[model samples]
Target: MKELFKQIPSVDQILSKKEIKDLIDKFGYPLVKDSVRKSIEKVRDEIKSGKLKEKIPEMVFELIPLKVEEVIKPSLKKVINGTGIIIHTNLGRAVLPESVADYIKSLSTCYSNLEYDIEKGKRGHRDSHAERLLSTFFNVEAATVVNNNAAAVMLIINTFAEGKEVVVSRGELIEIGGSFRIPEIMKKAGAKLVEVGTTNKTHLEDYANAINENTGLVLKVHPSNYRITGFTKSVPAKDIAKLCKQKGVVFAEDMGSGNIYDLSELGINDEPTVKESVNAGIDLISFSGDKLLGCVQAGIIIGKKEYIGRIRKNHLLRALRVDKITYAAIEKHMELLLREKYHEIPVYNMIFKQAEAIRKEIEEFISGFKLENSELEIVETSSKIGGGTTPEREIGSFALTFNLNKSPEEIEQYFRSREIPVIGRIKGERFLIDFRTILKKDIPILKNYVSQLLSH
Candidate 1:
């Protein structure tokens, strides 16, 4: 067999450069001459070794490279977020508003007053954009921002009590979204961790007993992810503030997943507002920008003027300061909030949307897909406030459910393989695309996907 295969002309010997170019021209740029040549060479090598018997009809397929421009594309492409998870942490939480995106695009294109005061024609601070607006909106004396909430907390702890003790409730010492624990962060800041109370219960006396000569700050951390249901007790910020003030200690709060607007009107759980925290006489307060605030990722610290000034002077401030683009976005977000334009915030809109309104949208979208006599259906569904905000809270929503010719797993795989990935939860052996987290604008995209499914 080997001798006979050798006698027959090898694929490399049979196919010439001109022949390959002819094939490429017929099949478009995908049939690149170089790739075709390599394929033929491999085929020739395999045939000469008498391995042809092991090959199948599928082995005839050839992968050719198109133009370099077509082959190489940008990694940061737009992806469809159909997972019904809002503020999806993995897919870059809290998309910037169109105006904010434009602002960043402008800065990226040319030079601006990022670190220079254009009016004064002199060097200036980059943190200037967000500082004033953040303070004004949150009702704080001053404010500063960092890369993230954890960075803000570390910078605060390192600044105020590097070598001293920071008293906190053991229950409040929580592990955030990532495995980043509070106690570990404090230790890294060179502050002694003085934990107070038990896992489910803590009292003002516990904090009082922990206080002593080494005590520099009384810290309160908000349990962002989980809430203790029954038989739970903890000291309020007002009481802790009074006790800390009497003992000459700075009372600081880490209000993780910070919120500014009232969610009660939207039928969401009423979380403590940032203004309330500041009003409780806490000296320093830090919270996140992206979570409930519906802004870009940043750690916002707002508190008394004197304490903010001290934090600004700390050596770590320079390292943790936010960029001009972040500052601009945060400033714009605050402006919208302060002006009572809640519709501008995407998160608030998604959470507050009524069931009737969402149902109407889904019904309109399904109408576009005639389904070629296929049985397409719209059913009532439930949506969640994802990103670890409310685990048990499910908002009323609507979804387009139907029976596909293929199996449930096949339908899911097909949707995912589209130009834009559509991720959703599966229930009762059916895949679902909940419209609760989906915006009205994304309906056209969903329609296109449904059209593709029907065609297939």
Candidate 2:
């Protein structure tokens, strides 16, 4: 161990190496020096653990550049969604319409009327672009965009129920992705939580009993990630809205995975459209922009002007406001929706893509796809609208099933480590790359990766 420690090059010695000098030129001296120190530390650890069989300084020097590259490499990159999860939260939910890229780029490269009203040649609000578009789709008096749906929830709760009681159904208290619970958010917003109803059932009377003089809000949370099966009963949003109206209490809903598209024809029937909630007379409602909306990350707040106007005035809205890039992406997405070109939206495109259409594409790809060392076949599978929207609902889809001498885990890792990671799933001892979540253009890219994997 003493000899191995001595053999490991010092940070200075490693930085002086020709390979590392080139890295320093590329990434600068501080980053290369840091990487060299990390490489030397790793070497010492490996030697102490008996993982290093040889005490060679050349071996240490050889890895210093790799460490430098890893340090400088980006952690966020493009990934192929072959997992059949459309609104996949882990993979950046809501694939924006391809048409929005140029607009986002144009705004990013140059500044326009992000806050300036060009028509009046004076200062203006940035939310006007998307807020104007949101009004046309929903029967809402006002709207605003925040950083995310969670922030919107916090902002609204703090604005309305900070010093009062917030009534929520026991069954409707949802823990969304990342363990963000409704009760916890409400508490953080400084609202006293009063949970009504049982886990499986909550009635209008329970809500009625929970509301009183101190009740400032009745929050209805839609659990998008899971479903309650038989014997489950929950009160309708309309009834709650009416009750809140009668009591003069603010009624708001955290409608998880807010859907605007009418997907009943595509077999996605359980999730209600955002228009229904807007039309149902909810005073305030908040939802994710990147989930079902197929836009950038934003917390879209839409409802009656009486409440929305108050939320807009909250100083916290400034803290939770989105930037110009998000506004541009959202503005373009709404434009496409307004024009009735819903198919241009990636989420809708994937949802509306029939199983037969994907199978046909798979069949065409499989006809010429040859793997000398593996087996590939077209198989029936179900795609999920991930990102906590309709968790139990499955869409009919097809996948390219893979069977190789290597374990399914090994096969999965091979594709996941590619230049553009191809994320898939393992089930029934087979690895499947579902085409539902994959764009038609990406199939060829995947084919190339599979072919390259075969060579290895």
Candidate 3:
């Protein structure tokens, strides 16, 4: 054991090797040193456990470069979404348009009027960039934005209902990603959550009965990720707004995935639009920019100027505020919406793409591949609008099912090991690639990837 341990090269001796010197030239010395340290630690542990028994120098030299490569690899690389779930949260929801990306790049590299008003030549509000567009698009008096929808909800509660009672239905208290619950957020905001009615049914009278002098607001949360049926009845936004108006209290709603256009025309009826909520006379409403809106991640709040002004003044607003890059991206996204260019956005393009078009693309993709050991076939599959929106509805889509040489898990791991990882779904012992979420430009990359894999 002592002889084996003595063979292990010291850090200075290892750094003197040709391969280690080459690695130092490629990646800086610090990274190479860290990799060498890690490799040495791993070898020591293995030797102590009696697992390492051969030539030690050869093993250590061979392991150092691999460890260096692994250590230097980036964690946030882009991956192809072969999975049929659009706006998949795990895959980074809502791919932004090219224009938005270009704008973000430009804004990130250089300074802009983030807080300066060019026309006024003085200090201005950062929210002013998207406020006019949001006000015009949603037909609201004023608007503001935060980092995310959860922040928007928290800010609203802390701003208006802090140290006061905010009535909400037991059924509408939803838990979103990361185990973030509504009541917990309300408590964090220093607001008293007053639960009204039962989980299955909540009447307008229940809200009216809950209102009192200490009641600050009546909140109606949209159940974005789940649905209740068969015996569930909840108060409509109009009725809730009317009750709040009559009771002289604020009425607000947290629309998790805010839609701008009516999706019913595209056969999706359950997802309500922000336009409808604004028309219902609600005092304030909030929704997400990254989900159904197909933009960067933001929490957009739109409502009467009175309530929005108060929300802007809240101390938490500074902590939850978005940066200039977000403002630039959102402004460009809103410009597309204003121009009535729904198909230009990635999420809408995926949702509204015809099944026939997707089938054609898949056929073209398959025509280029000459498989030796794998069988590929096109099959009809259902694609979902993920990101906690429209849980029960699935859009009609087409997928390519690959009967490969390896097991489903092995093939999936092989694809994931590629430079730009290809994420797919496994069904009935086969790997599936749903073309609905894939962009047209990604076809060439996918083709090259498949060709390389087949050659191997």
Q: Rate the local accuracy (lDDT) of all candidates.
A: 0.77, 0.86, 0.89
lDDT of 3 by residue, 1-456 (tens): 777788889999999988899999999999999989888888888788999987888888888998988977888898999999988999989999998899899889888999999999999999999998888888889999999999999999999899999999999888878998999999999999999999999998899889999998888899978898889898889999988988899999999989765667557888888889998999999998999899989999999999999998998999999999899999988988988888789998888888999999998889887766547789998899898888998888899876657788887888888888999999888888899988888888888887776666
Which is the better candidate, 1 or 3, if ranked by lDDT?
3
Against the hidden reference, what TM-scores do the models get?
A: 0.84, 0.93, 0.95
Report the number of the highest-lDDT candidate. 3
Segments in model 1 whose C-alpha atoms lie over 4 Å from true places: 1-71, 372-374
Question: Model 2: what TM-score?
Answer: 0.93
Candidate 1 residue pairs in backbone clash: none
True-structure RMSD, every candidate: 5.2, 2.2, 1.9
Model 2 agreement with the true structure over 62-92: per-residue lDDT tens digits: 6777887787789999999999999888898
TM-score rank, highest first? 3, 2, 1
Q: Which pairs of residues have clashing backbones in candidate 3?
A: none
Better of 2 and 3 by TM-score: 3
- Residue 285, candidate 3: Cα error in Å is 1.1
* Candidate 3 Cα lDDT to native: 0.89
Q: Where does the lowest 10-residue lDDT sum fall in candidate 2?
A: 366-375
What is the overall TM-score of model 3 with all chains considered together? 0.95
